[model samples]
Structures are given as C-alpha cells and as structure tokens.
Target: MLAIECAGLTKHFGDLTAVDHVSFEVEKGERFGLLGPNGAGKTTTIRMLTTVIPPDEGTAKVLGFDVRRKPDKVREKIGVVLQGLALEFFSTVYDTLDIYGRIYKMNAENRKKRIEYLLSEFELEDKRNERIDCLSGGLQRRVQVATAFMQPPEILFLDEPTIGLDPQSRRKIWQFIEEFSKGGYTVILSTHYMDEADYLCSRIGIIDYGKISALDTPEGLKSTLGGGDIITFGVEGNVDLLRSTISKLDYVEEIMAGDELAARVENADEVLFKLSEEVVKAGAKIKNISVRKPSLEDTFIKLTGRRIE
Candidate 1:
C-alpha cells in the first residue's frame, strides 16, 4: 500500500508560497527523505502531510486517510519528531515517556515495560530519573525521539531529527530507524544532512524554492549528474577568465564558481590537464585543486545552482 500520496499540494503564507504544487508518493515501509535548504518548504510539506496544517490547494492522504477530512484518524497512525527539541522542562526522562504512553491509551503495565525498553534502546537508562531540563541538549533530543516511539505509530515524521546530536548518538538513532523500517514502519525524514539522507533513505526528494526539483534514490540522483568527478580549483588570479576557458572544454559537463572554480567533467584527468594549461594562459596560479566522485551534494548543487550548506 502507498503510505502517503500528494498531488499538487500547495501551501501559501500570505504573500509567499511555501509549498508550490508538490506531488509525490511514498510506499509502505519506505525510508523517504525530503531534502532542501532552509525555507525551501521541506517542513511545510511535512506539516501538510502530518495534518498539522491544511494545504491551500490540491490533496494529500496519509495511509489512505484524507488529511483535511480525517485529521484525527490520520494523526492516530503517525508520530512526529519536529525540528527542535520539544520536551517538558520539569519532567524526568522516564516521566516524559510514561506520560506520552498514557496519552496514547497504553495501560500502566505496558507503559512501564515500553518506557523501560525505550530508555535502554535509546541508551537513556542512566538518565531515566534525571529531569529533562537538567540533561544536555543531546540527551533531551534522545528523550524526544524515545517519546515519539511510545505508541508504535505506523508512520514516523522526523524533521531534522539528528540536528544537534553527537556522532555516537546520531548513529544509534540511525540504527534504530533502520530497524524500525525493517519492521514495516514508514519514515518521512526531513534533514539538511545529505550524508544522513544518503545513509538512511530509500529515496529522496530535493526541494528548492517551494518546488520539487529532483526526486530519486541517492545513487539514482547522483547518476543523473552524469557520473563525473567534480574538480575544484582555488586560483590566485582571474577566476572568471579561468571559468570562461574551462566552460569551453567539450569534456566539461558543468561549471560553477563560488569560493572556488568548480567543473564537472567526464574525464577528470583529461579535463584537469587542459584546465591547468588554461589557468596558466589566463595568468592564474592554482592555489589548490581536488577532484572527487559525484555525491548527493553535487546532485543538489546541480539542481539548485548552489550548495545546501
């Protein structure tokens, strides 16, 4: 079954359009990612699908329930971990999960067992009795994540879920998410971390300026950039002049300049050699140079004309 479906889903914030005629489908148990720079409508799209907000036009269904007409039913089957930390300052880690489980109508015994399991699963056992406000930001995030899993919702919406987490904590969360996916949980992951998306998502949609710019699996998206190495040059003189020369090369697929002059070419060796000669002809001295295979970041840059940063 399709876990989520959207068709021309649009949202406007007065004078600005936050999500513009977006459409996509997510399959059951799939790890889907919404990738974009800030203000690119990634969060807005999640809100619409989660039934947190209504779309101005078009339609969305979460697990076959219309978001606008059956919001309560939709909410019942989904869990959300929003962008920032959301926790009660005075509640202990144990208390927080216990309270959430209670709200989900879990019985006392089940809540107790579930809470204990979650604390251990998320490596929060040591912080069980500690008040949330007294924990570090990472621990607070762990509590928030654990709370989301309390009811075992069919779908989980993770918005920048690992934003401030330490590397160890982040990996642990990734492992949990992977395991959850294997158990038939659908995850909609909205994150700025390209590597995280590449690591966890089965497919990704790149959004820019409120529009879906590209959609594919991580490798699929990277392949669309033509399977070339990205060559970056830090030059001492005449970057524009150097860019003009590099852009003329037949093997060069694309070029962009910011702090450095970068080009995508089919053969890095041939292009780099030609580029070196061109730079010298332009009276530019190469400060540094590097060539690497295409990555999700390169795909995003190709689509948006800039880095995600």
Candidate 2:
C-alpha cells in the first residue's frame, strides 16, 4: 500500500503559489525525501500533507485518508517533526512527550511503554528529566524526533531533521530513521542536505518554485545528467595558461580553471592523458588529478540554473 499520495497538490498564499501542481506517491516503508532550497515549497508541502493547512487546489492523502476531508484520520496515522522546535523550553523532555501521549489518548500503561521505548531509541533516556532549555541543539533535536515517534504513527514527516546536529548526532538520527523503516514505518523527510538525502532516501523528489523539477532514486537522478565523468586536476603554474590549453580540447565541453582545473569531459582517460602531456610541455606543475561520476548536485544544476544551497 502507498503510505502517501498527492495528486496535483497545490497551495497558494494570496497571490503567490507556494506549491504548484505537485504529485507523487511514496510506497509503504519507503524513506522518501523532499529536496529543495528555502522558499522552494518544501515546508508548504509538508504542512498540507500533515493537514496543518488545507491546499487551495489539488488533493493529498496520507495513509489512505484524504488530508482535506479526513484530516483527523490523516493526523492520527502520521507523525510530524517540523523545522522549528515546538517544545516548551520550561518543560522537561519526558513531560513534553508525556503531553503528546495524553493528547493521543494513549492509556497510561501504553504511554509509559511507548515513552520508555522512544527515549531509549533516541538515546534521550539519561536526559529525560532535563529541561528543553538546558539541552544542546543536537539533544533538543533528538527530543523533537523522539516526541514524534511517541505515538507510533504509520507515517512520519521530518522536515530538516538533522539541521543543527553535529556529525555524531546526525548519524545517530540516520540510524534511528533506518530502524524506523525497518519496523514498517514510512518516512517522508525534507532536507537541503544532498548527502543526507542520498544516504537515507529510497527515492527523492527535487522541488523548486513549488514544482517538482526531478524525481528519481539518487543513482537514477545522477544518471539523468548523462554518463560522462568529471575530471579535476590542480596546476601549480598560471591558471590562465591552463584554461587556454584545456578549453580548446575537443572532448572538454566546460573548463573552469582556478587554483584547480575542473572539466566536463566526454572521455575522462583520454582527456587526462592529453592534459597531463600538455601541462608538462607548458612547464606547469601538476598537483593532483581525480575523476568522478556526476553527483546529485550536478543533476540539480543541470535541471535548474541554481544549485541546492
């Protein structure tokens, strides 16, 4: 069963359209990613899916419940961790989750079991009694995520879940998300971090100006940019001289030379051979050379004029 579905989902704020005819489907247990830069309609889309707001046009369904008509049913099956920290600074982590459990109408015994399991899963058990204001940014993020899972909803929506976290905390969150999927929970996450999406999502939808520019698996998206490889090398001598030499090469379409020279080449090995010999003849020192496949950023740039900062 599909956990989430949107058919031409759109949202407008007065005259401006925040989300424009967006459509996609996330399968059950899939870790789906909504990728876009700020003001690209990612948050707006999340709000609509979570039934926090209604769409001006189009439709969305969460866990088979219509977000517009059956909002309560949708809300009952989904967990949301938004970009902002929704915690009360004066409250302890335990109390914050306890409150949500009560709101969900979880019985005392079940709530206790759920809270204990979540605290341990998120590694917040030791700091359960600590006030939100007393925790570091990473710890606070963990609490926010743990609170979302306290209800054991079938679907979870996490917007920038690891934004302020350190490397260790970020990895811990990733592990928890993976484990959540393993336990049959479908995760829909929004993030500007390309590496994070690449690591966690089974499929990613790249959005911009409220529209989906691309949708595919990470490897599939990269392949859409074509199969060519990128070759980058460093030159110790004059950059201008290197630029003039490399730009004229037939296989090199784009040559950007600075402290380093990067080029999009049709044949990586051939270009490297030619460049190496030419640099030697020009009396320029060769620092390093590397060849890599196109990245998710590369695919984003190819479709949109801007990068996903």
Candidate 3:
C-alpha cells in the first residue's frame, strides 16, 4: 500500500514557485528520501504533505486521506519532525512527551505505558525530569524523536533530522531511524547530505529548481551517468594540447582539462595506451593517472550542474 502519494503537486508563494508539478509515491514500510539543494522546494513539499500548509495546485494524499479535504485524518496517522526545533526549552523532557500524548488524546494508563517505553528506548529515562534546555543537543534531538513516536503513527516524516548534529550524534540518529523503520513504520526524510541519502534511503528523489530532476535507488541513479571509467592525468606542457590529443582518441567520450585532463572512456586500457603514446609523441611529461567509479555527487553534478554538499 502507498503511504504517501502526490500528483502534479505544486505550490507557489507570490511570484515564486516553490514546487512545480512534482509527483512521487512512497510505499508502506519503505524508507524513502527527498534530496535537493537549498530553496529547491523540499521543505515546501514536506509542509504540504504533513498538512501544515495547503498546496496551491494539484493534490496529495497521505495514508489514504486527501491533504486538502481530510488534513485532520492525515495528521492523526503520521509523525512529523521538522527542520526547526519544535520543543519548548522551559518544559521538562517528561512533560514534553506528556503534552504530546495529551494532544493525541491518549488515555492516562496508555500514555504512561507509552512514555515509559519511549524513555527507555531512547535512553532518556534518566533525563525525564531534567529541563529541555539543560540537555545536550543530541539528547534534545532524541527527545524530539521520542515525542514523535509517542503515538506510534504508521508514517514518520523527518526534515533534516540530524542537521547541526555532531558526527557521533548524526550516526546515532541514523541508527534510531533505521530501527524505527524495522518496526513496520514508513520513513520519509528530506536531507541535503548526499551520504545520508545514499546510506538510509531505499529510493531517492532528486529535486532541483522546484522540480524532480531524477528519482531512483542510489546505485541506479549513478548508473544513469553511463559507467565506464574516468581517468585523470596531469601532463607537463600545454593542457589545451593534451585535451585536444585525448579528445581525438576513439575510445574517449569527453576530455575535461584544468591543471590536468580528466577523460571518460569506454576502454580505459586502450585509452591509456593511446594517451601514453600521444603524450610521449607530443613531448609532454605525464604526471599522474587514476581511474575511479563515479560517485553520487558526480551524478548530481552531471544532472543539475550543482553539488549536494
């Protein structure tokens, strides 16, 4: 079953079109990623799906309820941890979760049981009575996540959940998200981290200029760039001449030269032989040569002319 679906979804703010005819589906119990650079409409799309804002055009359905017509029903079935910290520093960790439980209308007995489970699971039992402002950033994030899970909704939407976290804290949060998905909950996250998307998302949608430029598994997306071999070499003489020589090779698809020349070739061995003979014949000394598979960042660069950072 699809936990989330959007068709020709669009949003605009005055003259700015934040989202433009974007469409995608996320299946139940799946880990999906929304990847894009800043101002690419990822946050706007999240707001529309979570029913925090209405889309100006098209439609969206979350957990089978139309976001426009039945936002209340949709909200009941999903958990949201937005980019900004939503917690009140004056509230204790225990009180924070309790407030959410009350908002969900959980009975007193069920709420207490759920709180106990969450505190223990998140390792926050010891910090329950401590004020939110007194905890470390990581612990506070843990509290945020724990509060979201208090109701155990079927789907969770996290927007840059680990942003500004230390490396150790980020890894811990990733682990928590993975474990959360294992319990039969669908997880949809939007992040600017390429490695995070590659690591956690079963499938990723790459958005740019307020539209989806590509969508697929990480490996599948990389494969679309036409895999062969990429070789970079520095030649001691006119870099332009080196570029011209490498571009003339039959096996070479592209030759890019800066301080060095990087060539894309179908047959690395044949291209290397040709390049060696040509450079020697042209009296240019070869400095270095290395071949490598294209990374996700490479693919992004090829498609959008920008890096994900």
Candidate 4:
C-alpha cells in the first residue's frame, strides 16, 4: 500500500494560496523528498499531511487512514521532526526522550530500551545527562530527531532535518536517516539542500509558487537538461571566434557566460578535446577549464528560473 497519498491537495490563507493543488505519493520504504525554495509551500504541505492542519480542499491519506477523517490514526502511524528544535530546554536529553516515549504510550520496559537505543544510535549517549539548553545546536537537533523515533512510527516526516548544521553533523544525521529507511520505514523529507535530496531521496518532487514544477528520480530530472556535462573555460584571445568555431560541434548543446565560457555538451572528454583544438584554431588558448555534470540544482534553476536559496 502507498504510505502516503494526496490528490489535488490545496491550502490557503485568506487571499493567499499556500499550497496550490499539489499532489504526490510516497510508497512504503521509499525516501521521498520535497524540494523547493523558501515559501514554496513545502512545509505547508507537510503540515497538512501530518495532520497538524487541515487542507482547505482535496484529500490526503497517510498509512491507509484518511487525514481529514482520521487524523488521530494518521498521527499514531507517523513521526515528525519539524524545522526548529522541539524539545523542552529544562529537561535532560534522557528525560526528554523518556517523556516523548511516554507520550507515545510506550510501556516502561519498551520505552527504556527505545531510549537507550536512540541515545546510542544518535551519538547522544555522552549528553544523556545534559540539559537540552546546554547542548549545542547540533546535539539538540539529534535529540529532537531521536524523540521522533520514540514510537518508531511507520512513516517519518522531516522538514529541513539538517538545517544550520555543520558538515559532520549533517552527515551523521544523514546516516541515521539512511539506516532508518533501511528498516522499511517511509521517509518524506522536505529541504532546500539539493545535495542532500539528491543523495537521499529515491524520488523527488520540486515545488514552486505553490505548485509542483517537476517530479522524478534525480537522474530522470537531470536528464531533462540534456543528460550531459557542462564544460567551462576561459579564452585568452578572440572569444567570439572561439565561440563561433566551437559551437558547430555535434555534441555541444549551448554556451553561456558568467566568469568564463561554459558549453553544455553530451560528453565532457570528447568535447574537451574538440574545444581545446577549436580554441587553438581560433588563435585562443584555454585556461581554468572545468567540467560539471548536470545536477538537481541545475534542473531546479531550469524549471524555477531561480536558485533554491
């Protein structure tokens, strides 16, 4: 069964439509990502699906339960880690988790084991006795994420799970998320980090201005930009001649300029050799040559006409 499903799901605030007829599905054990810039209606969609808020139109179902008709059942089967820290500052890490476990109705015997496992798994064993207020931002985030697993719900909803974290902390969290997904749990992650989504999500849906702009696997989306590599270089002489001569190659797609001449090509090595020869023929020498494969970031810009940030 689909772990989560929505059809023409929409939400509005007075005159503004926060989520405009968005629809998608997440299968069991799938790592689904929602990609968008700020105010792209990603978080609003998550909130509705998690049943924190009701949609103004259409329908949503989580884990076989209709969100509009059975919000409690949906909530019981899902876990959420929202944007900010969601812990009580006064409680110690262990106590915070213990409290959450109790709230999930976990019995004492199971709750104790779950708490111990979470502390160790998240690398929070060292901070178990530390008050939530005393922990670093990364540590606090770990605790918050661990709390979500108190009940180990079937579906997990994460909104920007790694925001404002250091590289190490972010990777650690990614590892935890990966391990969690391997246990056959569904994860719906919303984030602005393109690399994170590209690495973690099996399928991605990009939203813009409250609508889905694109939806597919990372490679599938990148292929829409021609499935080629981007070649960039600087020419010391006669750039116009170089552009005119090199643009004729069959593998070359198009050229753009910012700090240097960039050519989108079907193959980097093939075009690199041809481009170098063309530069010499045009009486220009190449410098600072670089090759970049198409990425989700490039696709996002191609679709949204702007960067995710």
Candidate 5:
C-alpha cells in the first residue's frame, strides 16, 4: 500500500494559491522528499497530508485513510515535525518525551525504556534535567524531533527539520533519519537544501511557484539536464570575451556566468579542447578548467529558471 497520496491537491490563501493541483505518491518504507523554496507549496502540501489543515480542493490520503473523510485514522499513524518550534517552554527533556509517549497511551515500562533509548540516541542524556527553553536552538530542535519517535510512528513528516542547525549538527540529524528509516518506516520530508535532499531522499519532488515542476531520484533529476555534463572555467582576463566565444560553440547547449563561467555540453572532451582554443583567441588567460557531472542545482535552474534559495 502507498504511504501517502495527493491527487490534484490544491490550497489557496486569499489572492495567492499556495498549492496548485499537486499530485504525487509515496510507497511504504520510502524516504520521499519535497524540494522547493519558501512559499512554493512544500509546507502547504505537508500540512494537508498530515491532517493539520484541509486542502481547499482535491483529495489526499495517509496510510489509505482519506484526509478529509477519515482524518483521525490518518493522524493515528503519523508523526510530524513542523518548521516552527512546538516544544514546551519549561518542561525538561525527560518530561517532554515522557509526556508525548503518555499521550499515545504507552505503558509506563515501555515508555520509560523508549525515553531512555531516545535520550541516548539524540545525545540528550546530559540535558535530561534541563528545561527545553534553556537548551541551545539546535539542541531544542533535536528534542522536538525526538518526541516524534516516542511512539515509533509508521509515517514521519519532517518540514525543514534542520533549517537552523550547524553543519555538524545537520549531519548528525541526517544520520539519525537514515538509521531510523531502516525499520520499515515511511518518511516524507520537505527541505530547500539541495544537498540535504540529495543525501537523504530516495526520491525527490522539485516544487516551484505552487507546483511540482519535476520528480525523480537525485541522479535521475541530474540526468534530465539535456543528458549533458557541466564544464566550469576560471579565467584571468577577457571574461566576457570567453563567455561570448564559448556561447558560440556548436556543442555548448547552455552557458551561464556567476563567480565563474560554466556551460552544459553534450561532449565534455570535445567541448574542453574547443573552449581552450576560444580562450586564447578571446585574449583570456586560463586559470583553471574542470569537467563535472551535472548537479541537482543545474537541473533546478533548467526547470525553475532560478536557484532554490
């Protein structure tokens, strides 16, 4: 059975449409991702699927329960970690986890054991006595996510779960999510970070302007960039001339300039040799040139005409 489904799901906020006829499905035990920038309908889609809010139009289901007609059934099987902080201000770490487990009707012995395990897993044993509000932002974020696992949910929803975490803390959470998903659990996480989506998700949906523009595995999405490779050139002089000269090449399908000049081409070897000649003719001194596989950022630019950020 599919873990979640959204067919022609739509949501509107006054004059703006937050989600527009969105459609997708996630298989059981799959780590699915919603990749998009802020206000691009990622959160709206999650909200509807989690039964936090109803879609303005269309149908959605979680674990085979229709979100609109059987919301309580859907809610009974999922865990949600929202973007904003939802932890108690004065509760200690131990109390927070214990309280959540208690609400799910977990027995005392099992709840105690789960709390102890989570305290160790989230590296929060030292903070067990500390109030939630007294912890650092990243630590508090960990506590919020930890609460979701208090009952071992069958489906987990994470919306920008690591938005404010540092690099080290971010990787820690990534490892945790990866490990947690191994026990036949389904995860649907929404994130704007390209690397985060690439590293964590088995499949990704790229959303923009209230619509899902593309959906595929990370490598699959990269392969859609005209089946080409990326070549970036670092130059010393005549940057514009180099760009113009490269742009005229027959093999160059797309050329862009930022801190450096880059192009997407069908054949890397042929394009490199030809571009080297053009650089000399254009009066530019070559600093460096590299050939690399196409990336998700490249695919996003091709589909959305801008970076996710």
Candidate 6:
C-alpha cells in the first residue's frame, strides 16, 4: 500500500508561497526524504502531511486517510517527531516514556516491558533515573523520538531530527532509523544534510523554494549528472574569472560556483593539468584542489544553481 499520496499540495504564508504545488508518493516500508536547506518548505510539507496544519490548496492522504477530512484517523496511524524538542523537561527519562505509554493507552505490564526495551535500544538504560534536564541535548532528542514510538504508529514523520546534534549523536539517530526501518515501517524524513539523505533515504525529493526540483534515489540522481567527477578548485581570488575560465575548458562539462568553485568534468589527467593552468592565467590562485565522484550535492547544485549549506 502507498504510505503517502500528495498532489499539488500548496501552503502559503500571506505574500510568500511556502509550499508551491508539491506532489509525491511514498510506499510502505520506504525511507523517503524531503531534502533542502532551511526555509525551503521541508518543514511545511511535513506539517501538512502530519495534519498539524491544513494545506492552503491541493490534497494529501496518509495511509489512505485524507488529512483534511480524516485528521484523527491519520493521527492514529502516525508518529511525529517535530523540529522542536517536545519532551517534559522536569521528568526523568523513565517517567517521560512511561507517561507517554500511558497516554497511548498501553497496559501497565506492556508499558514496563516496552519502556525497558526502548531504554536498552536507545542506550538510555543507564540514564533511566536521571532527569531529562540532566541529559545532554542528544540524549534528550533520543528520548523525544522514543516517545513517538510509544504508540508504535505505522508511519513516522521526522523533521530535521538531528539538526542541532553533534556528529556522533547524528550517526546514532541514523542507526536507530535504519534499525526501525528493518521492521517494515514507513519513515518520511526531512533534512538539509546531503549525507543524511543520501545514507538513510531510499528515494529523495530535492525541494527548493517550496517545490520539488527533482526526485530520485541517491544513485539515480547522481547518475543523471552523467559520467563525470566533481573537481573543486579553492580559488583564492578572481573567482568570477575562474568560473568563466573553467566553463570554457574542453574537458569541463558543467561548473558550479560557491565558496570553492566546482566543475563536473571528464576525469582525465590531461583535463586536470590544463584546468589548473587555465585557472592561473585567469588571475586566480588555486589554494586547494580535490577530485571526487559526483554526488547528490552535485545533482542539487545543478538543479538549483547553488550548493546547500
């Protein structure tokens, strides 16, 4: 069954259109991602699908229930971990989770077993007695996510779940998501981190300016950029001249400008040698140079004409 079906979904904030005519489908057991930088409408799309806010136009259905007409039914089958940390600050880790289980109408015995299991799984067993305020930001996030699973809803909506987290914390969250997805659950995650989307999502919809610019699997999206390696030159000066100069190179297929000007080029030693020589003549000094395979970031850059930060 399709986990989500959205067509021409739009949301407007007065003068500005937050989500403009967006459409996509997510299948059961799939890890789907809405990828873009902040203010790109990733969060807005999640809000509409989760029935947190009604869409200004178009339609959205979650697990076959229309979000606008059957919001309660939709909520019954989904779990939401929003951008904000929605945990009780004064409660201990154990009480926080146990209370949520109670809210979900779980039996006493079931709550105990489930809480124990979650504590162990989330590595919170040692921190069970500690107050949530005493835990680190990462642990608090982990606790917040655990609460969403109290009901063990069919679908989970994660909006930049690891935004403020450290690298280690982020990896742990990714691992948890990977583990949960193994049980055939559907997860729709929104993120601006290229590696996060590329690693966790089965297919990604690249959102820019509140619209999906492109939607494809990570490898599929990279393949669309064709056979090329991204050669980035850290230009010290005259970047504009360097961009214009590199665009004319016979071996350079496409170029993108940013802090470090990057080019998608045919991977050959001759191409690299000449590209460096041309950069110098263009009055730019190459502070650093690196060559790597084309990635989802490259695909995004090509689509939106800039890099995501």
- Each candidate structure's TM-score, on Cα atoms with residue i matched to residue i, is 0.95, 0.88, 0.85, 0.89, 0.92, 0.95
Which portions of model 4 miss their true places by more than 4 Å? Answer: 234-250, 255-261, 273-287
lDDT of 4 by residue, 273-309 (tens): 8777766777877666878987898788778877766
Clashes of each: 0, 0, 0, 0, 0, 0
- Cα lDDT computed for each candidate against the true fold: 0.91, 0.87, 0.86, 0.89, 0.90, 0.90
RMSD of 4: 2.9
Q: What clash pairs does model 6 have?
A: none
Give lDDT tens digits, candidate 2, residues 62-108: 88899999998998888999998888899998999999999889999
Please give the lDDT score at residue 123 for candidate 3: 82
TM-score ranking from best candidate downward: 6, 1, 5, 4, 2, 3
Best by lDDT: 1
After best superposition, candidate 6 residue 222: deviation in angstroms? 1.4
Off by over 4 Å in 3: 229-248, 251-291
**Distance (Å) between predicted and true CA of 203, model 6?**
0.7
lDDT of 3 by residue, 1-309 (tens): 999999999998999999999999999999999889888999999999999999998989998999999999998899999888889899999999999999889999999999998898778899999999999988888888788888877999999888888887788778888998999899999998988999999999999988999999999998886887778776688878778876877778766323456777777876677767777787788887787776676677777876665
Q: Which model is ahead, 4 or 5, in terms of lDDT? A: 5
TM-score of 4: 0.89
The window of 10 residues in a row where model 3 has the poorest summed lDDT is: 254-263
Could you tell me which residue pairs clash in candidate 4? none
